[model samples]
Target: MTNRKPPLLILLGPTASGKTKLSVEIAKANRCEIISGDSMQVYRGMDVGTAKIKPEEMEGVPHHLLDIVDPDTPFSAADFQTIGKRLIDEIAARGKLPFIVGGTGLYIEALIYGYEFSEGGADPEFRKEQEAYFLEFGEQALHDRLREIDPASAERLHPRDSRRIIRALEVAHLTGVPLSEQLAKQTKESPYEVILIGLTLERNLLYKRIEERIDTMLANGLVEEVQILLDRGYSPSLVSMQGLGYKEIVPYLQGYSSYDEAVYLLKRNTRRFAKRQLSWFRHMKEIQWVDVTDSSNFSAHLSAINAIIAGKFA
Candidate 1:
């Protein structure tokens, strides 16, 4: 750890793990401002789908990087790396703790590890050909091409994630460096003194939570929210529209899947996504896990976390 590095408090967990409320409580108590690490939350029109905290819900704790771009605009982990690190520095300079709170493992890792994208050998022509391939077939086809070249990254990415799939193929084609190798090749040094906190619940409990969260979203005008975005001229194929809650609801709104069917699929897929999130965090050894299942209350959990922070920053 760098002796002079600013403190970074991270609160991470799978979807519906109550990370947002817990993070807010901790941040409010500790004079910390949160920098969201979510990919979908950056889009301007996305709210319920991204599980975004409303302004009144923020409880006066400042947040960064939410509602940053339009649905059609492309944002990547590289963007998060740049913007997130800058917020960490800016927050610390203002004499407040910086809290990075989200379930996006790649975004968090990129910020913490200072990941360098070696674009030294990038070939725009080759990248254009890849983009043409994506347009001809689909983003899944693009990811399939990557699977042949870089299986490590392919496993981590969703099939519709064209931006990362293209970048991986570009790296392999130009420099013979797969995206996995580029990240793994770097020395494992975190720039900030991160007080990492990972929240978890029982598996069955978490699945139940996922189902209930979907139910709440539906009741709270999630379908209407998607309609508003479509009404605003965003296409269904836009990357932001393909987010978990947004994409599943599209079929229903387009006169395809019934509302019940869309709701069912959303719940099922979200459970699977939560499982993948836990898998991602499991591999990141730095996060100290706390089973909210075992805790009596959230206050107790925060108290325990404060002890951990004390040891790190004492």
Candidate 2:
């Protein structure tokens, strides 16, 4: 038997799992154009906090979908799917593999499986109440409310993503089925010959990398970056501002928390976020998981991944 869908390659994993360096190397060797699957990286001027790839870091391998919107604008999984699908086709047309590389599982899954978003109208009153609740109690408390009704959806969604949390809550309230259940019922059939590669590390080592990454971000002026965004008039209430690094720093800048307190919260929240990422990707049955815990053995890991890709796509 033979399958003939267009080839698509995805390199995804928890944050700080070495996806960035590996993806660029794989792309350069495989003649692939990389599209970012990270939700936060889509916003312009969020470079430091998102750990967005600098041009020099790309090493001439073409990348797409980074810095595409303002911090205040709302970008969602559906937007990623629409644009990602187009890029995949265009890249395939040029005889290059379209490699989606990032830790954002929902965005990648939505694009790969063609998730149809429900058009169920929202109740403004319900939505307003949810917003008010978030404002009063904060994102984690609001996220906990969703967890009670939709644990599956809650597991995949970041606590700071209050917008989606509210939507999931609304969907459950309106339709009586969890948003995760609706997505699970969606046709899982993909439009491409997809090869999903997942990277992982021992939990302790992964946490080390995450902490180091955050330290590097702070040293590289993450605070200044957030300050710039605030100066540009992006409100702290915007969904993008609720992102990991930005949100944690906001209280510090507003004189509510000390710099040390903000840093601690950022590191802890990032670790929790990474754990959620692993949980989400683990639920996707198609991914070929690889352990790249040893930074000293880069070639070994890359070779193994390339072999997997070649075996499937060659």
Candidate 3:
């Protein structure tokens, strides 16, 4: 490890858990710039569904990695790590702190823990074969195949997570090794001296917040946003379109489902996603969790975090 300390702060939590607001506050206080950890927020014109921070809400805290990629372009975790690390270094070089904030656990972990991806190249032919297999045999058949190869990974991934499942299978087919084994072999010490601050709230309140956010998105022209993307020739099958709220509402836009049904499903899926995020972060032993159930007194949480940062950097 290098003797020089790298300044990086990570504020992470589930969706609708108030991470964005807290992160902005922390960044402004620390003279830091924010790098978003969200996978969807990287895509341009995905504002409403991704719940991207409005320009006014930023309060003059500069943010990087938001709206950088086109929706039709493929983005991967490895790509994010490469770009994120560069930005982190650039920020630190300027004598400012780097605040990484988002609810995407995989993206956050990739940046903090430093996962090494295989040097495997994408095989269009193999992807087509896997897509055909799913179309012919269904999702369960593919998941069962994954179970036979990597039971542990299969256990964690839901069957309906077609994207990851397909990627795993494609990797196995091309490399002749299970994807789990590849991930297992790849590890590195994080280059930064980092602090992980996780924000959470009561389950009931979090769910309520998610519902209200979905309602706000609908009212704020989320459907119109999706329609514009579609008009731009973006496929519904694209990875960007498959994001949480975006995918759920596509059918409604296509007249296959009622708007009410679409909103209900989006809220339900978002709640489930938040629960999964909480579970994932809970297992990371290094995190200092803040329960913001009573937002009336955020000072306690803020003070605790400041104390930790001072202890680490002093």
Candidate 4:
């Protein structure tokens, strides 16, 4: 009984670090199924911007929790925690490994720790007011405010992520406690024995990859993807539309900003986002960093992951 480890695996890396393909390959070879931990990827009709994996890319390995909500519907970290925990149980019961994959640090943290969000109850009217304020003074102003109160949370989140920034600010304002401190107070009560595998690369190469991916997304119709979302009556102010790609394109689509300007901002913001993601993961002590600096070491990385699984659960 002591040797029987709880089954849960995590494949984490920044955007454009090649998590999807590596996760699928590992799942295919090891009879594992993937559970997406991405906050934005849960929305429908927002594919290109979120870099969603097509069915073909999944290669027959079952995936869960992607495209499960509309752009307007609010999906919280608690919702993700509930869905992800259930999927892990169901997949393990069915004799497949449950691999939680994505770069969203808070969502992943929710799965690996116990925390109560009850203190941060929403004031819809106040949130709307904050949203309007954000538009007026700009995202940088909002981020600076958050940085003053909850520097840790601000560091982990992108400046343009108004929804989270608002929430963090709200928590601090209402509770008289910083959002980061509240999360820190939680007792770690993770149910599964999580083997967190982090994919890493040289900084220069990683930035290059992020830039190239932004270019690829634009070429692959990311702007058109936002056009469809707007055409469907999803507001530009919706939490989902405020995502990296969608938000950058909204100005260009509305003729307020030039296409080149939007593209430049997208690439710059994406690089910043990736840096925040890396900063977040680096703080977590459990992650086993694997350098995939060269593509040739991919097989070696897989072997390293397999060895960890074997050592823990075999």
Candidate 5:
């Protein structure tokens, strides 16, 4: 007979979409632990900008993967998949539910689909060549190159997305195959049955929440947080510093822009990021969308989630 166990429940959505609070409430009710799926939140000292859950906010529910790595260290989706799967197993072993929560679609997808990364070696020299090409010719130049070799991949990537552009080029150079084809060839079953719950709102309301969140972060010592990281010798070029709100303030700290200007730019960029996140989640066929515009009521949402979980586990 097949062993009967409960599936993982994933709470995912764009930034500033009320995920942390809702996830905490759900965990409290269901006797579950939350394993964060966010990429940035893994870095130590990245608190305010990442909107990390504070100790008081945890409300006695355990959260995993919030502050595990140094900001300068490399953390990939593959690494997240390995660590998250282990955490889920451990949580299950403790006789509790595992709830995954965050806005990072790639990380969530990696966990839910168990995507495998190729062990194909990357050439530092080749990577440098691509980086130089990106620096000199701009992201469009690299995106155009991807268009020629892998139209499918290029179509998926935004021309302004420098990191993914470089990654696509690196994958193509290392494997002698289009990055899209490499991804297409990889197939792995999910290690856990999962229920993906996607939180969303109307565009205007979402943007409003994002702007308000930025204000709250600023009022809550976001600049001080970045200052502390900088004081600790974390470079602006580090991955953690490159996160949404953190990166925009680097210029201000360096005297390139005023603090107010930096805040404005940060809010604008955050809104754009939220839009991209929504687009990504919209393409995910498995997600059960929850609209929070009218009510913003956690009780209502929790009731819906509890009913879904009960049905799945019953």
Candidate 6:
């Protein structure tokens, strides 16, 4: 039987893996309109920290879903799925290839696989109670609560990640199923003619890139950008603030950690986050992995990616 599903190209990898640059090249060549798969790039005024693509850097290719929300708004995988599907259809309707590009695994997974998140799974009161508990007892206690209900989730989440911890607990509380288990049971079926491409680098080289990216962010006013968000009355406790670059810098701005310490933590945490991203992608099925370690040969990499897309979509 011939599959007539809409074609969707996905370019994903860890932070600083050159997904942004490569996606742009491929998009321009392939008549593709790029929809950001990044969870953080959606936030307004968070450019430097998220490594958001600059206007001039876009090179005339249309990009969607960047700077769409305020810093205080909560954006979940379900939200990404809803908006992403709509954008993909819209782009496809306009006779452009729909390209999803970024490293946020959960959001990408939910969108492509059409993960169903039950409305009954959410309880505002339960969330409020967990937030109160986190405020009163600290993040470790909250994480400990998640550990009892969803050990796998706890194992993955850091103790300081109170928001995710609370979310895991809430999923268990309202749905009577651990968040990890629910995720594990998702039907990994896509409605689209999906092409999943992953960019990877050698571990040491990837870490070097991550560290260099952090340094570039710092040089480009990352601290000031974070301070501006704080000045706008966005609380550090907000989930958006807990993101990679923002979270590490908040402590320095608040005098909780020295600038050097904050930078050190940012580099270390970003490296760890990249490792987790690679781990998540490794577990996903059907990714055409490309080793982009030798970035000196840009044309070769672009050709390799285009060849992969042509094979799948032709």
Stretches off by above 4 angstroms in model 2 are 1-3, 136-141
Q: Pick the candidate with the highest lDDT.
A: 2
- Per residue, candidate 2 scores C-alpha lDDT tens digits across 85-191 of 99999999999999999988889999999999863668889999999999999989999999999999888777877888999999999998899899888887999
lDDT of 6 by residue, 1-314 (tens): 87599999999999999998999999998999999999999999999999999999999999999999999998888899999999999999999999999998889999999998882457899899999998899988998888888987886776777877877888889878898898889998789989999998899999999999999999999999999999999999888899999998999999999999999999999988898888788889799999899989889999999998886776
Residue-wise C-alpha lDDT for candidate 4, range 9-36, written one tens digit per residue: 8989998888997888888767899999
TM-score of 4: 0.93
How well does each candidate superpose onto the true structure, as a TM-score? 0.92, 0.95, 0.91, 0.93, 0.91, 0.95
Sort order, lDDT high to low:
2, 6, 4, 1, 3, 5
How far off is residue 162 in model 6, in Å? 2.1
lDDT, each prediction:
0.86, 0.92, 0.85, 0.87, 0.83, 0.90
Writing each residue's lDDT as its tens digit, candidate 1 over 101-167 gives 9999888888888888555567889989999999999878888899998988888777776766787
Instruction: Choose 2 or 4, whichever is better by TM-score.
Output: 2
- The TM-score measured for candidate 1 stands at 0.92
Clash pairs of candidate 1? Answer: none
lDDT of 3 by residue, 172-200 (tens): 88888887677656553677788888887
lDDT against true structure, model 1: 0.86
- Compare candidates 2 and 3 on TM-score and give the better one: 2
| Displacement of the residue 43 alpha carbon in candidate 3, Å | 0.5
Candidate 1 weakest lDDT stretch, 10 residues: 305-314
- Model 1 superposed RMSD (Cα): 2.3
